[model samples]
Target: MLTTKLGVLLSGRGVVAGDRVRDALADAGLTMRSAFTLTQLAAGPVNQQTLIDLLGVDPSAVVTVLNELEGRGLVSRQRDPADRRRHIVVMTADGTRTLHTVEEVLDKTDDDLFAALTPRERDQLERLLTKVADADSCAEKY
Candidate 1:
């Protein structure tokens, strides 16, 4: 039963279902998935390579996403003052507002996603998921 459930959860339906959540978020103009780039930028100025590592996306893809965000006046990328060889990306005021909107949407999305779970179960799930995320990074270092 456990194996069957795991297999189903790993199937395309599960993937698409998760995509639907992002789609719904994007439909509102927040674009939560790509906004990870903006959110990372919002943290502080980070170079393109840093975004690539943070988002785990291809270099070309990262450039494309940054281009779109820049075109929208949401972000700015410039030659790092201290490191001419690297470009630093930073969020504008608009980007900060948009990131806040995305956070609100994410809060709603999470509530909807975990609607079936009790508060205690939700806490347990968060702990377990954090552990899994940590393990993934640890695996990458090995």
Candidate 2:
């Protein structure tokens, strides 16, 4: 069957897992994209273009996400001092708390999703996935 193909199986599982994680994030009033953005901003402030690069999404898409986060008081954007045209993005205190909450949500979701796998198997899967991801030239775009 087509599902037996490695690529097909991997794609199917990836979609399902991504959906599950997105659902969990939604319950916390965040999108997967927004959560990822918050995680990046948690480290330090970065300009909008940097987010556009890191997210591997269109500049408009990054603006939309930033708009959403700003509306929610989860992030703020101010003009970059070095570049008047660039806007620096930073996570708010609420954003930091929300990021922590989503991290816990993701941890729980991962546990549930991989319950069928043993601890060793889970570790192996992570390593294998990382290896495959690292090998992908497309991944370098992000």
Candidate 3:
């Protein structure tokens, strides 16, 4: 018997969608973590510690990601004027362009995932999900 549980269904669908998104991002030469980093900097500069905390990863892992992004000219780290010991991460023009590409890729993935839904249904679903996401403080950055 099929269980009628929204949480279970949503979790399963989320995993599938996540995989699809990861694959699409990979084609654009980005990983989820790297794309997230760029997305965070899209708003403005953030100190390295902020990134590390946002990413919830080892400091070294964040450094590796930063190194790769810097090497690609997507981002740069500059010493913060307020605090010389802290390095602020800023997205470059190239990174902005790449972030746009990432958005397009995610949009495509959304379309693919919601292909079964009618336009109206998609809109309704988005509204409902937005409400849920809005309730979560962490969703603001995402």
Give candidate 1's TM-score: 0.79
Tens digit per residue, CA lDDT, model 3, 1-142? 3556877888899899989999999998999889988987888889999988876678998899899999999999999999999999999999999999999999999999999999999999999988987798765342
Which candidate achieves the best TM-score against the true structure? 2
The 10-residue segment with the lowest total lDDT in model 3: 133-142
Over 1-142, each residue of candidate 2 has an lDDT whose tens digit, in order, gives: 9979999999998898989998999999998778888988988899988889888878887898899999999999999988899899999999999999999999999999999999999999999999998799687432
The superposed Cα distance between candidate 2 and the true structure at residue 68, in angstroms, equals 0.1
Q: State each model's CA lDDT, in order.
A: 0.76, 0.90, 0.90
lDDT of model 3, residue 66 = 97
Error of 3 at 2 (Å): 4.7
> On a 0 to 1 TM-score scale, where does candidate 2 land against the true structure?
0.89
Candidate rank order under lDDT: 2, 3, 1
Candidate 1 lDDT over 81-122, as tens digits, reads 888999988888988888888778777777877788999998
lDDT score of residue 115 within candidate 3: 99
> How close to the true structure is residue 136 of candidate 1, measured as C-alpha lDDT?
78
